[model samples]
Each structure stands twice: as C-alpha cells, then as structure tokens.
Target: MKKKKLLLTTALVGTMAFGATIPTSLAHDALGSDVNKGEERIVFSNEDLKTLESSLLKGRKNVGNFYEAAAVQIQELEGVQNNTADVYAHNGYAYLGTHTANGGNGGVRVFDLKDPSNPVEIAVFAHDVPYTWQEKVIVKSVNTPHFKGDLAAVSVQQTSRNNSSRPDSVGGVLLYDVTDPTDPQKLGFYQLDRRITGTHELYLTTQGNRALVLASSPYADYYTHGENEDFQIIDVSDPSNPEKLWGSDPRELEEISEKFNGYHWDAPDGHTRPVFNHSVITDNNGQYAYVSMWDLGTVIFDIQDPENPVYLGRTEYRDDQKGAAHSAALARGGNILIETREVSNPVGDGYEDAYGYTRILDIKDKTNPVLLSEFTTELTYDIPETSQGRTTFAKTVHDPKVHGNTLYLSYYSGGVIMVDITNPNNPTEIGRYTPESANVWGVFVDRNYVLASDMGQGLKVLARGNKVVNNGKGR
Candidate 1:
C-alpha cells in the first residue's frame, strides 16, 4: 500500500455563496439508498423517512481562501428538477442528462449553445412512460456500420425509489438519430434482460464503420450472477440495429471476487465487501478500456479486439484504505491514468465518516505502474449532521476531465476543483468554484469553457480566465 500524499492545504473551504437551505422534511436524498437491491433503485422506507427527519442541519457558512473564484459561471440552464447527471457537447449543441426527481421526469435536455451565455432549449428527448430514470446520454458524429451521420445514445436505469410505482420500467440503452440537433429520431432501443441490473454508465467509441459500447453494469457482478455482468460490451455500428458483442471473462471476475471477498468498504454503517463497475473509458484509438471498479481498484483491459477483451492489469489499494474508484481520464497520450474515487458518506466536524480523493498514476508502463501522487482539498462543512449538510466538503470525486495539462474534476459537495497536472508527480489545485449548494456530478473541459452538470442545478458553463477582484476588470 503505497500512500503518496501531495502538499495540500487543510484550510480554505473555497468561495461562499449564501442561499436558503431547504428543511429536512422537504429535502430529498441524493440518488437514494445504496442498500441491497439488484436494480439499484432508491427505496425510501419508514426507516429512511425517520432518518431524514433527524438529518436536518444548517447551510454552508464559511469560505476557503485557496478558492480563486476565477472560474466565472457564465450561464445556468435550469431543468425541471435539476438532477442533471452528465453533459455531452457537440458542434454547437449541448446534450444534458438528468436523473429522476420529484417534479420532473428523467430525460435528455438539448440546448442550442450557438450562444454560450444564452442557450436556447431547442429540443428534449424524454420517455412517455409514467416513471423515467435517465442518467446519461452521448451524442457524436459517426459513419459506422449503418452510415448514420450523427447519433445519440441514452441510458435508462430500470430501478426507482418507489419500485411498485415503476412496474413497466425496464433498463437499457436508447439510440436516436440526432443528425438534426433540434429534431432527434428514435433509431432503436437495446433493452437488457432481467438477469442483470440496468446500465449505469456507458463508454462509446467509433472506428472506421463500427461503433462500440462498453456498459458499466453497477450491481450485476460475477458474484451476484454466474457470469461477468459488470463490463458488458455491445456493437451499435448499425444505428437501427445493435448487438451484444462480449463481456468480461466470468473466470477472471470470479477470481477477483474471491480475492476481494473480505475487502473492507468505506460505508459509514460498517465494512461491506462488494465489487461493482462505476464507469469505464477507452483510449482515443479504442485499443484499451479502463474500468473504475469500486473496492477492486482500477482494472485495465485490452479491447483492440472488441469482440474478445484481454485482461491487462490493475492497481492495488491498501487494506486499511477503502477503494471507491468512481471515474477516470487519460492524459499525456494515454501514458498517465487519472482516477477519482466516489465517497458515499460525509466528513469534516459534523459527519461520521470520511471519503477518498483524486489519484494520479504513472501508467507509462501499464504492467508495472507507479502511483505518482494523490490530491485532496480542505474539507469544510456548514451542517455536517443532516443529509444536505453532510455533503458539504464531502470531498468525493464524481467525474474528471483532462485538457492538456489541466485536470477538471466535479467534486460533489466540494464543488469543482481544477488541478495543474503538468507535473503529474506534483499535482496542485489551480482553481475551484464551490457554489453554496453545490452537488456537481459531471464535468467536461472544452476549448474555451468548461461544462459541469450539477445534481441540483442543470448545466453550468464556467470560464477559467481572470480572477474576481472587489471591482475586477473583465480583461
């Protein structure tokens, strides 16, 4: 267990924004319970309600100095309920994905970003069913198997907080012809069987005339089933027709499951040994797929042969430290792997448990990799006791994006933290923006601006330019 800690500040909670905090009775849980359930749905029982009653706390009070307030938030696209999970931007359009919420149906929100500051809500792709649980969408130009100019893929998780109310809900991926950003056509629907849980996140790629999809099935692992259910691959070259290509080897999955059967998790309740794929990413060439396997560390696979993947290697974690391995990004021509860990609980003065941080690994030699350094910001909390307040400075990483030498991370309650990874061995926090009620889920860095999806707010476009002085100049 090599613990590589960088020079990090244990103070400065970041820019402070004052807002009205919702009461516990009116506040809802984040993504719901993570208890025993094959469908990974949110089930708020009497006990859950009782817990929520006692979890009401105050809002954020202090601000950190390290926070530059440099990343100026230019625009905020509000959704029905604002459970935005991921954002995918194309030529001039931004596709925003949403999770199920109280007053909204989970669906895809498309905006014409022809104007960055003032985006127009041109179209929306949502299911007509009573219960909808869409978490992510990917839009890209393609000349694949069926010659579809532009395509969009959306994920529908079959689980829900109230399972009985979503009887007709099913889990799978939905394909659409988005050649026209304003009007998307339903191309196909690739639904999965009940044997496995719904797809949580998908890694999509295109080569020549073929499109590949590697889905991250969260709860359906080898231990739960007799086969490898975590990393299932599918070929959707033909937009109208999709096919399941292959999945990770069951034998390999079984081996790892047995090895980590006694692995300790970071659950606030107790130690729970479980393995699941939180997300996966492929290199530009689509030669390999890196999986963020929770508690199992990061797993690598050679996917040059999309039909048959070969296990390459994986990173090891200390027994004393729990592995939350949530998401990752590749940098320096895929030589370095930057991974983020998802923390389920809260930390700081009022919380009971702590969480993991961002890690930089030197994978120039995939077989024999080295941990370069680890980065984490100072954790601060306003009301650490309640459900809403506990997330304050819940310094957990949800997703990350790498542009050249800079790494952009969506740090849940920690807001967004940008690190200068020019020197991978000494990654330092360059800039950060923590909204008063920040619960950022995804972040993507573009040419000029960075797009982040917040669980409470929709799409936010931020610029990493000049800092904000008492009376700062635009230039």
Candidate 2:
C-alpha cells in the first residue's frame, strides 16, 4: 500500500483556533445539538455569534497557506444540516441541502447566495419517506463531465426518528431541471428500496448525455434498522424517467455483528446485513469516485467509465478490523481519500472507545488503497457516546470538508477542527472552535470561509473578520 504524506506540519496539537467571532460570550457555542423551544432543531445563529470566524490558517512552510483576517459572517439558514454544500457556481448559483425533519418532499431546500451573507431560499423538493428526508443537490454545467446544463441531482433522506414513514428503501435521488430557481421542476426520481435505506450523500457522474447517479443508502433509517442498510448504484441518464440499471447486487461484503460501538446494532446475535455506501467524493476531473464505504472504509472506484463503476479497492475504517467510515472526501489532491471513521449507534461503549476520527487513504494504487494518517480529539463528557444525535443525544465528528489544501471539519461536541493536510502522512490541527451549546453535525467551506451546520444555531458562517474597509487612499 502506498502512502501520501501531508507536506505540511505533521500534527499541530493544542492550537488556538481563529476566532470566527462567536462573541467571547457565545464563543463556547457548539455547531449542532440545540433544542429550540421544545423539539430538537439545527439552527445557524448570527445573534451575538458574529459571522467573521477568522483564525490563523497554519501549515508546514511549503505545505499550504490560508487567509488569516479576511473572514466575515455572510448568511445563515434554518433547516439544513451536515455537509450538503453545493458551492460550485453556475448561472445564478448557490448552495443546496436536505434540511428540515429529514423526510418528505419538503426535505429539500436551496439557497441563493448571489449575495454571500444574506442567502435566500430559492426552492425545495422531496418525496415522503419513512421519516423526515433531507437532501444534497448540484446543478449541471460545463466543465462538469456530463455538462448537461439545467440538470441536477439530490440524495434524499426519507426516514428519521421524527417520522414513521420508514421507507422500503432508505430513500431515493430526485433529478431536477433548475433552470429557473424560482420554479424548479422534478425531472425524475429513483429509489434503491432493497432494504430500509437512506441515500445519505451521493454524487452525479458524467456518463454520456445522461449522468449516472452513484448513491449510498444508509441502513437504520429509523433507529432499529441501520445494521441491514447497504448501498446501490443507479443509472439515471434519463432524468425525467430514471432507471436502476445497477445495484440489487450481492453486498460485496458481509456485516459482522459484534459489540463494537455499543449501540444495539441489530443482529447482535450474529452479523447483520451489511450497510454499504455513504460518502462519495470525486477526483478533480470527475473521472473516478472515492466512496466512504461505511464499514468497508474508503473504497476507490474506477469511474472513468461511470455506468460500469468498477470497484478498484477498499480500506477498513475500523481498522484492518474494527469501527466504520461514515463519511469521506477526496483530499491531498485527487490521489487521496479522507475518511471520517465512526459508528451510527453506540450502546454503552466508552467515549474514547468510540474513537471516531479521520483517516487519509492513498487511492492511487486503485486495487490497493493505503491508509496514511488518522486524527481524533478528546470527546467532551457531555457529547453523546451513543447514537449519532439522530434526534436525541448529540456529539461526535460527522463530516469533513476540503478546500484548497486544508480540511475543515464539524465535530459534534469536539467543535470545528481545522487540519492542515499539506502532507497526507501527518495532519495538523491548526485551530478548533467549540461553542458550549453547539452540537456540530456538518460543515461546508469556500475559498476562505467555513460554515458549520449547527442543528440548534442555524448556519454559522465564519470568516477571518469583517473585511476591514480602508478609508485612506493616499496614505
């Protein structure tokens, strides 16, 4: 197995995070896990939580360099949670997410960020599911492999603890024609209903004229079913009327039932049906797809040919043996895949034992993906050590986002951790932010800004500082 080293600092521990301006008073605020009124809701607050979240962007000399003080708070949204960011601009583009209760047609929402700070909701789309459904979407454009303008895809979360609409499958992907953001049309939708699965996070691959939708179906849409969840690859070339040309195949791997994370991961008596699929990030060219294959770790696929997604290799998130990879992103350039290791449920497992973390995998070898480095912070005593705050107990790092050469993460209770991965081998935590009440669920970043999808706080846009406007011209 080959390894990619983080050209930057090996590891920057106990570092002070750039202040995203969450008032020193609310500075200890967390990103997610907030109970609004009575029900648990993900909120991004600007009240007293200043927008400018600027902290020093660190790295090992030749590794990487990010802005320090230019950060500013731009906007905040109420419902979206997790890394459902669609920042690539096209037309009057912005960001999109699967928000609200997580299921139903209302699960989908979009923001118009033509104005960076004040993001406006353009549209929403979703179909009913066993629970509340959430979503992720991207509009097609040139430069993209398929480059079919006006086309886009969204992965819907059809089930959650909030609802009983348990899906025959977790959920499905909906194709849309968003030429007119004000009035978007649902072109098509397809479900991988083999088990009660949720298409957590997925991406559209440029195949031919039609894009192939590669989605991950998460098991346990409600609370008792994740053990049997798995993944499926669908062919939605015909958006208006998509088809499941693939999937329904044997779960390449079997899920072993063990007292791992503690959660009552069903099938305790024996190995439950494997829950495959999850995070799927692509190379710069969109030629290949790197997926966070849940218990399978990070799997690299040779998608040079999208339709026949040839599986090249797989990595074990738990180890050559234990835990699991919940979400992953291609980092350290296209050759490496960054995997977020975790378990959906932890019954009585010790917090430290849960050991959720991030791993860097070398995917250049294809058939033999290699692990480079891993990082984890000490969990707070209050963070949930059980089920990932589905709608209850909270805490744990859920998603990691890569921008430039640095990686920004949303830690459930650990707060926001920024790592410098100039060298994949040794990642450094340049800074971190953990507000007292924040239960961070997901994160998204652009050129120089980071946004934490806080369940109770709204959308916290962090930047260096309010861009200081200079008045002196001829100083």
**TM-score list, all predictions:** 0.76, 0.67
On the 0 to 100 scale, the lDDT of residue 6 in model 1 is 15
The residue pairs that clash in candidate 1, if any, are 12-64, 13-64, 14-64, 42-161, 55-386
- RMSD values, in order shown: 12.0, 11.7
lDDT of 1 by residue, 1-475 (tens): 2222111111221222212232232111112232111121232322332332121111111212221211112122242333566888888787887665553355787877766665676777755434556677877788864756778888767545236655666667788888998888888877765444467788778766788777886655432433335667788888678888776532243233222321222333233434567688899988888988775678887777777666667776554454667788999999999988766554422223556578899987775567999887665223356666454324556688998988888876666777888899998777666644566777877775667766655666654443443322121
Question: Over 4 Å off in model 1, which ranges?
Answer: 1-82, 161-165, 222-224, 253-272, 346-353, 380-393, 464-475
| lDDT, candidates in the order shown | 0.61, 0.50
Worst 10 residues of 2 by lDDT: 28-37
- Cα displacement (Å) at residue 287, model 2: 3.0
Could you tell me the lDDT of residue 346 within candidate 2? Answer: 33
